[model samples]
Target: MADALVSIQILPRTPNGESVIPYVDRAIEIIQASGVRYVVGPLETTMEGDFSELLEIVKAMNDEMIRLGAPSVLSQVKISYNPTDGASIDRLIAKYRT
Candidate 1:
């Protein structure tokens, strides 16, 4: 069970004022490599996993953005943690998914 749910929308500032599509693509690539249950919305991407792991992923996303030529990044993050029963991406959306 996932101990937390993390949703993030990263806005990486391009050094050359180029389109950020490629940078955003790299961020999503990091998420894909994490192998977590994730949903990519138009504005944000939500993932379910351990808090530490998710946080690490966030760092990796930021690092990758910098390596990809982003001068800075602004991330909007939301977290839901339930240590007892744990939060689930599927369970939370099952009703709507049906």
Candidate 2:
């Protein structure tokens, strides 16, 4: 099982001040491609995986924004880490799923 859960919301400043949704979409795409278990909430996207790997993913996400016409980025992150038994996204959200 994954040992950590990371939730992130990246706000990239567009070069021309255009809509940020598209850039945000690209960030989500990164998460989608990561192959980790994730849930896209209204405010942020959460991923469950090894702690260090998840931090690397967050860095990639910010870099992606700069590559995609964003001048700068502001990313908010939250992490829950459990190394021994680990944790599953499913287990955490089970009560709210139904």
Candidate 3:
């Protein structure tokens, strides 16, 4: 079981005023590549994993944005952590899915 569920919304400002959708897409790609369980929503993406790994993913996303030409990156993050029983996205929202 995972120790946390992290939801992140990344806002990347391009140097040339380009559309940020591509950058956002790339960030999501990083999440996908991590192989953690995730859910993509309209305003943010949520991932379930170890607390430290999830934080590392956030760092990777910001670093990639800078490498891709973003002068600054703004990230909004929400975390739900349960070190004892652990956290789970499915366990929280399973009732709504039905």
Candidate 4:
């Protein structure tokens, strides 16, 4: 079982004041490449995994934004950690799904 659920929204200040969609897309790509279970929502992306690993993913996403030419990055993160019993996205949201 996963030990944490983390939701992150990254805001990158573009180098030339361009659209941030592409940057956001790249961040999601990093999440996908990490092989963690995740959901991309309208405003944020949430992932389920070990608490430390998920936090590392968030750092990687922010670093990628800078590498992609953002002057700086801001990441808003929410975490639900249950080290003993574990946390799961499916278990939390299943009731809302059809």
State TM-scores per candidate.
0.94, 0.93, 0.97, 0.97
* Best of the two (1, 2) by lDDT: 1
Give lDDT for model 3: 0.97
Clashing pairs in 3: none
User: Residue-pair clashes per candidate, as listed?
Assistant: 0, 0, 0, 0
Runs in model 1 lying further than 4 Å from the true structure: none
Write down the lDDT of every candidate, Cα atoms only.
0.93, 0.92, 0.97, 0.95
Clashing pairs in 4: none
Off-target runs (Cα >4 Å) in candidate 4 are none
Highest lDDT, which number?
Answer: 3
- Stretches off by above 4 angstroms in model 2 are none
Pairs that clash in candidate 2: none
Segments in model 3 whose C-alpha atoms lie over 4 Å from true places: none
Worst ten in a row by lDDT for model 4: 59-68
TM-score of 4: 0.97
lDDT of 2 by residue, 1-98 (tens): 68999999999999998999999898999998988878999999999999999999999999999998887899999999999989788888799986
Score candidate 1 by TM-score against the native: 0.94
- Candidate 2 TM-score, true structure as reference: 0.93
Q: What tens-digit string does per-residue lDDT give for candidate 4 at 1-98? A: 89999999999999999999999999999999999999999999999999999999999999899889999998999999999999999899899999
Question: After aligning candidate 4 to the native by TM-score, how far in Å is the CA of 88 from where it should be?
Answer: 0.6
